[model samples]
Target: MKKFSLFGLKFMFEVKRSSKNDVELYSTSYALREKIIYLILIMFIIAFSSKIGLLSKNNNYSVGDVVISDIYAPKTIVFNDKSAKEKIIENMIAQSGKEYIYSADAGRIYLETFDEFFDDIYALKNNKDSNVDFKNLEKDTGRRIPDTMVKDLLSLKVPEIMKLQKETRKFLENLYESGIIQEKATIKYRSPFDKKIEKLSNLQRQVVETFAAPNYIYDEDKTKKAIEEKVSQINDQYIEIKAGTLVAKKGEILNERRIKILESCGVYSYKKSLGIMMANLTYLFIISTLFYQIIFNRYKKDILRKSTYRSTVLIIIAFFLTFRFINNDLIYLMPADTALFLLVLLTNTKYGLMMISFMLFFLLPIIDYDLIFLVMNIASMTFGAYLIKKVNTRAALIAVGIQMAVLKVATFGLLSFFSEVETFGAALKSGEIIVSGLVSGMIAIALLPYFEKTFNILTLFKLLELGDLSHPLLKKLSMEAPGTFHHSMMVATLSENAAAAVGANAVFARVASYYHDIGKCKRPQFYVENQQNGENPHNRVSPFMSNLIITSHTKDGAEMAKQYQIPREIRNIMYEHQGTTFLAYFYNKAKALDPTVTKEEFRYSGPKPRSKESAIIMLADSIEAAVRSLDEKTPRAIEEMLRKIINSKIEDNQLSEADLTFKEIEIIIHTFVKSLISIHHVRIKYPGQK
Candidate 1:
């Protein structure tokens, strides 16, 4: 006996002398499609992610360094008018009776008093210590400025300066919190004047305020003299606010060699953020492929077949592993949202949920997540996928759009719990969230058809369309050979149960059975069950002609299936069932006419049944016909008939070519024989009936 292993089953489809040229090309094309799509989708995902900051650009500078010069201005210094300053000054003067010295000359103010301000400002610069600028009060003011007064003044003015800075700092902080600012803001403030105002520190608020104002009135001669003398004395003094990008100088260039120590830190940070987004997006494509293939394999013929829980889990695992190679390219093509959409469209709710959680990580660089954030994204993606999995319209794509909104809210909510971001970041306003979601939904709707056609994903909706028995072939089967149609249905039930028991695809079994006997439609009256009048067309025909007609059904079925463009897997069962067995009745009659007749002439020329499902259908067809001839269907008689028939086939090696083993055959025979006997079992005879 010629024996082959599981791998050999695939080899039969290869281009060999035995296979049709068309079938070989078709098989090769299908294999190419699988490999090409996966590679293309993966590459697209990585490319897209790189475009969205999910991947970093290697540059000569780091975050605190200037990428471009003169792009940003120094922090501004705005002061309240004299009226506001005078009010505090007058209060200070009235509170303290100490004699106050004043300078009305603005030049003197710049030369003498401005020095103190500059000193204070300079004290703030290059400290890298505390953020405050004012230095030791006792030393600067010679004990005139009390510690309490300095503290109180700085407390008031520092807060005011911070408030003045509120807008600029707000943007910086927003960027930082959102992972936009890769580094903290570097700040500096400096001034050239320092000595003049240092004497006023010990004075009460009234004195300090009175003298601090530049607009105070005084004698004209005295003011002019003070201004001239001070202006001439100090020509070089100036104030400078030096706040901008901080870059490494010549001496710091040596740090480049040591960057490896911090490279992991940067990369880790990068991976945690954008890297995650990259990985997840890449993962999403992988997950989607696994889902599409797994479900495709199971339900390719049925159209409406769903993924099993175990298969779904396998898809998640396969994709997650694929995610390990994720780079910027994956993020560029398929973000978390797009990946989620594809998964939901191809597979089930649970799979979508699983994938969405994985996708959240894909956007990690852009949307840094903690535990809370992770949970929210997972929930949102899962919910979104669940919402649109069964939706058959553009409106359902809106549900996918809601996923983007869900992502925003989910991200926001999580951040609110764990981050200082109270609402959407300044970059992402409430309106923006709505718009993004709506846009995403539109994208999903737009891309769905392309993916379906390109990837050959036969969704449930497509399955529903195919399942309608009103299709031309099914209609012909019903109208022309109603008996065979009924037998096909019964065989479908048996085949589906058997396939399911052995972890095969039940939906494929059922659908394949429906179309299996389509060949009988050409000669409906010749087949026994379809002949309502019990008229035997074969009675007048020679045994050889009768054999020719009977054997033609297999060829006829295969030809019709090809015309219909049925999938190869389904068509395989059609061609292989009945397995070239002898047409016993016709062969015997022919043998009687010619004693030299050979049995080989009567046997079918077959590419024998290759799978368990096809082999079972062949057995069931023969058994169903044989059982009908019984006068009584007792358990003992049924068992004897089933065992004898199966054992004879076993001895004849009819089941040799298929994957089904002897043990499986025993179980199949026992199950089927029991089912048939139970259906036809007779009740005990009543005494008077005879």
Candidate 2:
């Protein structure tokens, strides 16, 4: 034996040595061990792979690669766009080149150069050509310059130029050094420096104001260099995107810029979808492990022996296939409740609840984990399953549908409080929910007869139908053997109470009790119950003939049930009701005449009571007959007769095959005592009879 742990669960496999060879078997989850669920899971994967996008179309995606689908930020993304950083810095420096700055050196240089300009003009005047024409300046050989350079230069009077220099030169130089803005707005800061403004006389201020040139020059290279340095120290161009932001759309080109953004978010590729598929498949195994126990508790013994498995597969196919074709929004209209009721009717509530568990798993991937819709449907489905447990009429199914619809409406209303939609919209959606809920029960009842006939499920509705006195066989029994019919009804009534007390199917007990003696209709006059004139056919017949006539009723009832197309469950009850209880009167008479008489020869054919309901019918039938024969109509007499008859059954091993506890038998005895006492209560003696 080898034990290993996988997926948080331990599995053990025993390697057995056969005579031929050693064989190794792998241990796996129930879903895999049971090929049915494994096949269903395969179908699930194949059918919904594309819908849920479980398989990856393309996994190996890189930067600048376009995606096949929209990707979203799984978490907050914060990253610098490295590709856009350099270009952004370059643009910032180019814009900074236009700014002006104060340059005192350039201002002083201009003043000195102006004085040299005066020296050149005087030297020209001192030359032989004292009347130097400005027009001829363009052709001058030694130091030719543009006329604009000296446009104001030639206009200045000789003494005036010296005077201009004397008054403004000192102040203008200081002003330029202090800084004159060509554009005041270009200055980086508005706060003045600590230096005081130079005091100027009226004439000094006038000359300086009139003659000051803009010395605040823009050094493009210096400004560009400064900007480059400042921007280099600045932080990287980082972007912060909130969670769930759309990172990219399908087929969108993901350049380096977008790629950097994608890197900050969670990893996304087509391969992730493949991981989803694997994870969901594992979850399906978990779901199966959780439910298959209760669903198959009595699997082969009960409804599964019928067509329960086939019906289960059919429901699964119908649900998944319908969702595959119809709009997912219309999933509410699929009548899942009908499937749930069918399962409950065919098996039991616990099995139906187990199926609901399976349905929950089926719903997860189909609804894409829409919890609201999931809750709404599961609640309504469970409610309808429990509803059908007690109701036994076709008309009552309409009431069940109404109750389920009310449940759905209530669920939707509670859920709507969170969304708070408009009145009309909420009402409309609620109406839709109501319709969806009602569709389940309405359709279930409509197809119930077909399900019963096809699946061989004996539902409470079917049982009630069979118990009706108006049925042809039942009507014939009442007419031909009124006493037998009355006896059967009493047994049914008493058996129903006992079955209910013992937690058995009371409806089955009652319905089966009604038909347990239908064979007596064939030999009504031979039985004591229908011997209207107290005639004793047994007195006329030999003991062997009487035993044969009386013991044949069990098989006779079974045969009659088949002839009338009764459900096998009811037919089995008729055969097992008598078990092999010895007919003491006939057997004793036979032994008196012939010394070789055997108990088995006088006993009914012995299948014995194999179910709680059948065991209950056996006890109820015997007790009712014994209580009827008691001369004293008293509670003490009825109790003694019930205990004596029930004890006789117990001593004879009549209930050995039944699944009844001692406590359940006690409860059945107590219930029978109360019911029999009420049935045989002392009546008023008639005037002449006393």
Candidate 3:
């Protein structure tokens, strides 16, 4: 798990155990090969990913955004320029003059009305002694003559009154020639009428205000007729745009007018397609990197046995791809829950969850669902993944699947209630939807065996089955080689304890221990453990011959496991349990006879234990035999013997390729000592037994 950073990203790669030259180090080429394979897988996913959600014929265009490509008129289009036609009619109306009816009678009436008003003032002036009422005189005239004007006129002599009357007649004549706007009896204060009125003295100004009116009528019928004639002269203007004519160019900002034109030409487009594709590219890369960090780093084992990696890749791709075909009604049935359970069983719950977590990011786009469905699946998948972690039987798988089904339904219902999904009842009530969660457990059981067999993996169920003592291989060892069988059982117990203490594969260690010495069954009498008569076969043979016999057992055991169809890891354990260490008994026997005897002549040929399980079993095998051989059975003797044997294996470099750290090795040694002491502990003697 030690990591190094490159740029800003931290990459994870398992550091090598002890020596790079060790025969069992994972080959760099295999690592490279798997990376290439997974990269191709990522590329494949991205290539088809557009179908997942990307749209090439995208229409999410906006005005003012640059065009992606040149838009052309699909067909010839000829249409009227309505705005241009309206402009032409507006100008014609501006140039047309308004018709007005002139009134000569209006002039005479104005003069006579003022003359009468002046005569009233003179009568009031002459009748001052008779107490004449001026209020009555003002109302008789249809004018609001000011009191000053009336008072001035009343004070005027006959000559002044006649002169004011003449001036009023002149003002009326000017208005009659210029004409007033008499529409609604309101005055038109236009140029010519205002010129004469503005030059008036105070007295004449009063006369104009009281007497002036709209002498020029609007003449509505005449104006309406004139506008009709001007509009009739105008015609609809049109223009033709030919097909293939470039309406808009790439990189040009689209206006509303251009957008309408593109839509009419059937060519609206979005430039953001490239951006979407890039986002997808980044998405796939991050997930692939995460898979390498979480799954591959932890589970990368033998190059020859790559089923773990392949199966994970296969299952992930299959589950996400299936989302494409899952109907909305059956979305709850998406084997996401099932896929997750099987993945956890295939690898482990931890990495299985990580892979599924990445897979869920893409679920929304692939299924075209919102976060409600995504959250629902996450809740359901995580529940199923953890729920089935302890499942080891087909029935357990089914039971967990049933639990998952109920949880999926309940999760969907809650999500619907909170999110207010209107179709909750219809989607929930369907038998297919309700049972979707069960597929998590059901499909897992269905696929578990196939993956275990085809991929040569060890799921919990498979390991449990192998742990059964009644297995055919264990039974064969018991019948033909009882003593070796008993020794193997002790070794299995010791190996399991050591492995568990070091966090190695304890179950695999125990199961593999049962068959590690199966080759001894073929030559039961030659091996010390199986010789019930307590005979030493080495006494009957030359030391060289004895070395050959002892050394051949490892190779013979490996072949036996191969024939029994054991997994590659266990087969390796059978082969490597005996490292290339010199056989001291046979070598000493030969050296006593000849001083020149070489150490190589009595060594077992070994590739060495390469994995944690194999290495644990190797240590356990040596420690179990060494401790059991103690004549005094003392705790001090046992402890010293444990360190001696382990030191010898270390000196021989048997554990060099294994991933056991110094601390883990110490823990294994301690665990084996405790377990061995317990097993070999003396029982209390009965009082009368002797």
- lDDT per residue for candidate 3 within 388-482, as digits (tens), equals 76665788877877776677677767776665444534364335545665566677778888888888887777877777889787788899989
Measured with C-alpha atoms, the lDDT of residue 323 in candidate 3 is: 65
Q: How far off is model 2, as Cα RMSD?
A: 14.4
List the candidates' TM-scores in order.
Answer: 0.47, 0.64, 0.60
- The digit string of per-residue lDDT tens for model 1 on 65-173 reads 3333222112211112334444554554455332223333432332343245434633553344455443443334333434454454344455553442343234323
Candidate 2: 10-residue stretch with minimal lDDT: 188-197
What ranges in model 2 sit over 4 Å off?
1-269, 291-304, 412-428, 685-690
Candidate 3 lDDT at 447 equals: 84
Name the runs in model 1 displaced over 4 angstroms. Answer: 1-464, 593-598, 661-663, 681-690
lDDT of 2 by residue, 1-690 (tens): 899999999999999765422232332233223635543564465345524543334332566677888887654434566666788777776665455666656566556654554566665634645554543322322234444534454466768656756655765555665666565335321214113223554434433443345657667677667886878786666565766788878898777667656645534344654576677767666665555554445343433353666666666666666655654445555666776777777667776666655676666766555566678777876777777776777767767877887887788778867754345545765777677666777787877788788777678788888978898889989999899999999999999998887778888888899999988887888888899667788888999998887888878888988888788888888889999889888888889999897888988887899999999999988988878888996877777777888888889999999998989988988898899888878787878754
**lDDT value, residue 539 of candidate 2:** 84
- All candidates: CA RMSD in angstroms? 21.4, 14.4, 16.8
Candidate 3 lDDT (Cα, 0 to 1) = 0.72
Ten residues in sequence with the least summed lDDT for candidate 3 = 50-59
TM-score of 2: 0.64
